[model samples]
Target: MNRPSILWKLYIAAFYVFLFAPLLVVAIFAFNASPFPSPPWKGFTLEWFIGNGSVFGKPGVLMDPIWLTTIGNSFKIALPVALLAVIIGTVNAWVLERAEFRGKTLLAMMMLWPLVIPGVVLGISILAFFSRTANGLEDVLNTDIDSLRPGLPLVILGQLSFILTIATLIIAARLRKFDRSLEEAALDLGASRTRVLRTVTLPFLQPALIGAGLVALLMSFENFNTTLMLVGSDPPLPITMYGQMREGATPAINAVSLMLMLGVGGIASIFALTSKAQQ
Candidate 1:
């Protein structure tokens, strides 16, 4: 057995520092009483965390109506995207992995093509495609395009376009390791195709399904470039944050960042524990 060299230990320590130092700074500054997020080390305060104005004689950073609404809107888009993307992705994974058909290669390539496209390009293309389609509908139906505004619905679709591919890949990788003999035996004995899928395949794929959905949820929540193009009037948290930052950053943004980190960290911790227990 050999110990790592002193240089290697220093290198690993430096890598972790580079990775987490910024996050640590952001977390620490969330409690800063200063108006701005940067240093000169203002005294610590809980004003940003609790939103308890009575205690501080002023409202916290999280009290803005638009910020609260943006948070809600993010959840709205992310939830549906996670569900729909997972469903479509699971079916696509199953079909691609278990079935035989013409154009299969083409379909698989199409599934992965979204990953190669830049988000900005994808957003612009989707906006153009939908705008043209909406125009055509307006001409045909002789109605206003108000109902067809690229709002949350369009945001969901845009996110789903790429997120579904992520789901498919995650599930597909898990599917590759699955033992088909259980499925074959179930089919041969008494189970129908749907039954086999429901009872055997889906159960076996549960971990992948959950992991993929969580990933989709996180991606949708944090999405900016594509959501910015298609979000219309209802901005998600990322879009709102970007707009705020362009003006100037405040401790409020740091507080928001801290909250997000805590929320995601909590979820990830739970997921890790659950997976470990299952194992």
Candidate 2:
């Protein structure tokens, strides 16, 4: 391999710095002994990890119920959304890729609409539509629909609307490269469609399926705007952090950010190592 040109080397260095500099700063501050987040690092301390009932006037350290609940809520939403997106998206991809139908291009374009729509707009639209539907249902049934409130379920629905499209696109792209003859051969050999799919197609699609689900989960977890508009009372971690930041910036917030960064980074590292080992 040829050595990188000076310009390319400079660009790579700049890109890495840009990507990691803020994270490095945040991690540094998470351990800084100074009360203020900005610093002149007084010294290193772990009190930021565990402090009095609050961090710089924001609820508390990571131990706060709100923070814990927010994290739980995020996972609750993300997990279901990932599962549902994979199911729906996989079906959609299969149909589009296997079935020869009219208006296929149009259908493909329509599938991409969610990706193109702004998150805030999508959230508001979903909230308005669900609100009206829920009110109508309540009027008809004379019962309340508590599950529709700003919580895990609503957040999942909001995220799935867009994230599912992404999953579909990924799976569909993979489907385009698949050999259909294998399924036909399996069916000719007495295997049912379900059996063929379960034994053959699914295994082939596993990598794409996993990738898409991970993408959907990450998108759902990090989502804020749609979650903000659709979520009623309880806020997810990002929203909770936003509220804390607005109220007052604190080292605890920084600490929480650092923890989150490390958690995600660690998961990514483990995945990479495992994947390499498998290879």
Candidate 3:
């Protein structure tokens, strides 16, 4: 068993090739000089990433104001979603892991609902519920309820609804493995509950919290189905990319994808290093 059978070796090789070949192609095509990313590759250029948008020049992802604005909107939405989701997740993890209450098993099962629901269905439900609630409130109360209308706020809420579930699961998994004796020891020495939590509990949760926040941020950034239902006048980067792809395929999309892959990969690497150091 020291060596894999020929069939197993072939399967393993195919698996890796299948996994990475498309990404490698995308990286290569990002620099393709052709306006489109199809076959018959032209020389090479960075215009898709940094062009000046002259009469003959392509307005790269960086040069396009619309793309930049959409990118900004994505960050605007993702940051808040990540932070708030993490906070909610931490609270959920604490309650679910440390405290017990009536219907705990049912509540725990309910927390997994989001993980199984289809994203588009979830988006539509949230949109419809909020829209009707807003209408009802405006009609009865005779006041504007702008926040309940479709917009970034609603997008954040929709994303948060599902993302917090993921975050909660992650944090709770970590909290489950935590040694309670540390907190008990600190408390036995007359440490306040808040102090013990702040000093001991939170420190132990650093890795899980960081992982959850990163997942939330990335998920929010690339989210499409839910975002599509809830987007307002402003669109996020993924929505903008969809619009562009609908118009025509271009090397610019590849360039943007390559950049995202590099950026996210770098952030993940750093996070891994930091977590290792903390350990």
Candidate 4:
């Protein structure tokens, strides 16, 4: 085996440091004994991890319902979005891979449009269209419709616009590399299309589906810009965290962040191990 050059080693070290430095800081502060969440560490304490008060008293208190509800809302939005994205994206991937159609490139570009467009712009557009549509419905029916205001549905819609694209790309990449001979053999053996898909094609796509689902869930959970504009009264975790940060963040925020990071990391690690074992 060839040893890595000094420059290559330095670059790798720098990249690792860059990625982990912020996380290390957050983890450290989550246990900081100081009343203040920042520098000048007073001592070591785990009170913040248990949802204790910070230097800011009421504002710094952890494990508040507001934070919990925000997390719940995030999960509520993420679960549905991930499921829908996977379904739609899987179908899209299958179609694009198996069928040769006109406007294929254009359609592919359209699917990916959300990634290029700024999140704020997408949020505004969806909000405007929904608002206008809701108003028109109200005007035509002559009925009040307050439920359409920014909420879970709006958040889901906003996130789906982009997450679906991610799912499509992931599944499509897998499809492109798939061996069609197996599917053809199944068909030659008189298996129905649905049966072939369920038994053969789907098994191959499982890993990609799992990965896409995770990505979609994470994207929806951490989304802030679109959620802020489209989420009416109820805010997701990221929005709540942003608000807290704006209002002089408490150590509780760090605690919550630490918990989230750990949770996500644990889930991802488990998935990785499971996938490796299956392989």
Candidate 5:
């Protein structure tokens, strides 16, 4: 038993090392003075953090127009997707958890279909369906259909289709643990359903909704496979970074990655702290 426990501890240590070592390397390389993100330790520098141009040439930070625009685009797509997904998902969870119907099982399965489907396939299907539908509409109207073209709107829609399922699952898990007596008591006190839901149920589900929103935001922000198939000329940060890498990127990419890591880590810490405090 002692030997097995020792071995398990060593295994767990090794697992964490394997998991976090690469991230540490990337975090370190983000400050590498050299142009490239590799090899012999270059003296630490903040040029990459600010922007390559900040030290040597033109003045630009990660907040420069190009990078900033991509960031904005990512947020633009993610924010709406998160909001819509959480709202729809919370409602769906309520129905699935509290209401009974003949086809409830089938409906539940269908709602979760997107979670099981490959993102690439989902993206491609969405693209094809929209393209065919738009083409048909254009043929009927004899006009340009650029307004309904694949871009930010399609990205949001594609992300929502799957992300909402995630939100639904989270909300449903929380809903299942809820005390129905509170709701029943509220109803018995002559409270309207809408009032009961707003005052009691929504508050009860707040944490789950926040968790789902955070998850959806991160998922939308980092999503590549689905966004790739559906994006137009303008790409989000992940796609942009991928392009830069293919075109010979520098430590600047590492710097952006580090910033993202820090931001996400910070957000996660806040969530953790808040959840603990509530508990």
Candidate 6:
């Protein structure tokens, strides 16, 4: 028994090491003095974040216009996607959970179809559908439908197509566990449906809503496969980083990776605090 327990602990330890050692290396090399993100330690420096006013011919991630633009574009797409997905997902969850209608199971399955599809395939399908529609509209009415072309709008739409499903699943799972008696009791005690929902139901769903929103935000930020298909002139961080890496990127990419890890950690901390407060 003791030997089995010791082996199980070692297995868990080894699994975590396998998962996180690369991230650990990336974090450490973010501050490496060398321009490349490779070996020999190269001491430590913060130039990858701030740079030395361009005298050293290295602009760093923050100093680089392309990197900044990609980062900005990532935020622009992610914020809206998260907001829209959460709102729409909450409504879908409520409807699915509280209401029963004909073909309800089919409707639910249809709603979740996007989750099973590959991200690249989903992106391609969306692109093709929009392209056909745009071409038809142009040929018929000769209008400038540039907005429908591959860009952030399309990226957001593609992300939302699947992310909405994930958000719905998260919220709906929580909703399933929710006791309807509270709402019913509140209604019986002269509270309106709106009041019951706002005061009682929403409070109970606070954790799920936060979790859904956070998942949506991070998914949008890190998404690459779908974003790659829909991206046009402007690229997101993942796409930009992939391009830079293909062309032999500098250690500044490490800095960006560390920044992302820190950002994720900070967001997770806020989520923990919010959940605790709600409890």
The candidate maximizing lDDT is: 6
Clashes of 6: 0
Put down candidate 1 lDDT per residue, 44-102, tens digits, no spaces.
88777666566544456578666688899999999999999889998899888988999
RMSD value for candidate 2: 3.2
lDDT of 6: 0.89
Q: Is candidate 1 or 6 superior in lDDT?
A: 6
Per-residue CA lDDT of model 5 for 1-279, tens digit only, reads 556787799999999999999999989988778867797887988887676484645323374566778888889988998899899989999899989889999999999899889999999999999888889998999986864578988888888889988999988988998899999999999999999999998998888888888888889999998998899877888889889889987777787788889878876876677455434
* CA deviation > 4 Å runs, candidate 2: 1-15, 50-60, 266-279
Number of backbone-clashing residue pairs for each candidate, in the order shown: 0, 1, 0, 1, 0, 0
The whole-model lDDT of each prediction reads: 0.86, 0.81, 0.88, 0.83, 0.84, 0.89
Model 2 TM-score on a 0 to 1 scale: 0.87
* Best-performing candidate as measured by TM-score: 3
- Per-residue CA lDDT of candidate 3, range 1-279, in tens? 998899999999999999999999999999888878887888888888888666235688899887788888999999999999889999999889989799998999999999888999999999999999999999999998988887899999999989999999988988998999999999999999999989999998988888889888989998999999999988998888899789986788898889889978976886677557545
Question: Model 4 over residues 168-236: C-alpha lDDT tens digits?
Answer: 998898889889999999999999999999999999988888888887888888888888889878888
- C-alpha lDDT of candidate 3 relative to the true structure: 0.88
TM-score of each: 0.90, 0.87, 0.93, 0.87, 0.91, 0.92
The model with the greater lDDT, 3 or 6, is: 6
Predictions: Cα RMSD each: 2.5, 3.2, 1.9, 3.1, 2.2, 2.1
lDDT of 5: 0.84
Model 1: per-residue Cα lDDT at residue 163? 93
Per-residue alpha-carbon lDDT of candidate 6 for residues 1-279, written as tens digits (9 for 90 to 100): 556787799999999999999999999998888867899987878889889536447778888887789899999999999999889999999889989899999989999899889999999999999899899999998996986899989999999999999999988988898999999999999999899999999989988888889889999999999999999888999999899889998888998999999998988887778656554
Worst 10 residues of 4 by lDDT: 52-61
